[model samples]
Target: VNILTTLILVWYSPDAKADAPQWTFLLCALGLFAYQSLDAIDGKQARRTNSSTPLGELFDHGCDSISTVFVAISACIAVQLGYNPSWMFFQCFCATTLFYCAHWQTYVSGTLRFGKVDVTEAQFTIIFIHVISGIFGPSIWSTKITSLDVLPLRFATVAMTIVCGSVSLFSIFSVVFTGGVGKNGSTVAGTSVLSPVIPLSFVIIPACIICLKSVQNVYENHPVLYIMAFGLATAKVANRLVVAHMTKNEMEYFDSVLVGPVMLFLNQYFNFYIDEYYVLCLCTLWVIFDLMRYSAIVCMEICDYLSIDLFHIPLVDHPITQLNKNGTTINSSVVNTGSRQTRSRRHHH
Candidate 1:
């Protein structure tokens, strides 16, 4: 639903404000609200259906890592931020960075912490922005505040974003640097606490270089496609990080998803023998395919190993049996009993 809503914005309001139908903004507002509600309840539904597993958690986060891009783009379009592509770029990437850092912090601390003002609050704020745009048209964000006289609403929004992002980053960094849960203050994966930074930089540095070096104004002309492609690449990296954290494995510095950004970067380096726009379209397609393929294969492997279904709960409840470190068969019924007891205690509270 969220992807379909973003596609609508891309079709009718590619430039966000120019020639956009008024109703599209309202639809965006509705679609995003629905997405948020569904996302919130996904875990509950899994548990209710007796389908919760580590794969469910990974799949949920994996979808969220990608949805971050769609939601950010939809909000940008709602506020008509495409007029200033640089600001649009900052806002979109800032969102992805915050999300990535949250998981990075998790990789170090062995816990996912939420600040007082977090994702749910941010989603509501964006929903409100969409509602305002839907009612007043996207021009309202360009109007100066009656009291301030100099501050455009959109710049004010950007300022708020920067401030909130800064505080969030500060909090994440504090946890990441101080909360290692492995030997000699390393990460949960038993690697140096800072090793994850290399993988993150690999994702961000190439993105910055490619967007800045687009001689054909590819990013300027196709900000949505450019950002979507970049978002998918980042999402793939985020997914790998999540998998590494779950499996207690080391993350690779290079990823297949980087191919998309590298394609555009190398084309520009050689003076764009193929038009940058065509390359961008192809890059976007490749990133989408690569992310989807990687996600499918990983999920299937996890399901096969765990002896679980991806989307359905078996009608007959039975314990999953697995070999332990001692090579003894262990029944998962004990784990399920503990989970149910935890749920029961929470319900009482």
Candidate 2:
């Protein structure tokens, strides 16, 4: 999805590849509108059912994470940032990095707050920006902000960058102060007591690579980059799921709003090419496979969580028996006696 969405921008960039027709904006706007509308309903439905499971949370965050990239691509298109690499890097960095910061915040603070406007809330606002740009033209965002006289997009992007930057800074520093009494009498490990860096490297390393490659554009084929990025993204999401499950914490998904403007700056200053399709295919397929594997693991874990039967029904009954060549007999009672004894010696979820 990361590669696909990025390609969409490359092909449609009027200033960069210029492969897309003039009507690209209409198509993109409509797709974004439909997606955002449907996205809004998912949370409502989850609430209506009063069932918020790990799967639902994963689905929500997974979609939001992927869509965050798409939103950046679209915003860059709207602002005519296709030919600017510096801005492109900044935009991608802003979106991806800020989001990672949000998760990190929850991990350290043990709480997630929106302050009235969160990523999802800002998503609709961004969609509105795309719609206006699509209709009145991308130039609208470039128009100066009244009184301030700065370009609207410029002012908005700078303001967002500052605010989100501060939040990220706070979260990063909070890691050092985490240990204390937690909900349900659980101990919250503070950075002073312990550092989750090793485990968290599973989250940070790939993120750094993604933001770096997005800025560099050195790979003729982006397979290595995309595969690493997607795999890490999924793992990071799963990490949150596991932590939330074990800690019984709740979190919300959000995207950094400044990616669009940062992308504009990158394009305006140092435009680079990212249309390496074959490499993208490799990366996308790898991530898709990773998700499949992740799903299987999750299913198994869920079954274990519920203590659902995994072995055949015959194993549940004592009468089912198998006779060996001579006189030996294998039955559920004998099999379970040993297995159950072994299992009893271990721990369970």
| lDDT agreement with native, every candidate | 0.84, 0.49
Question: Which pairs of residues clash in candidate 1, taking residues 3 or more apart in a chain or in different chains?
Answer: none
Q: What lDDT is reached at residue 172 by model 1?
A: 96
lDDT (Cα, tens digit) per residue for candidate 1, span 1-349:
7788878877977765564666877787898889889888888877666777889889889988998999899888887888889999999999998998999999999998999988988888988988888888888898888888886788877888999999999999998889589888888899987888887788788878888877777878888888898988888899999999999888888998888888888898888889998888899999999999999999999999999877755554344567666676665532243124211111110
Candidate with maximal TM-score: 1
Which whole-number lDDT from 0 to 100 does residue 197 have in model 2?
34
RMSD of 1: 8.7
TM-score to native of every candidate shown:
0.88, 0.56
Model 2 Cα shift for residue 148 (angstroms): 11
In candidate 2, which residue ranges exceed 4 Å CA deviation? 1-11, 14-43, 139-159, 168-284, 307-349
For candidate 2, the clash count comes to 20
**Which 10-residue span in candidate 2 carries the lowest summed lDDT?**
340-349
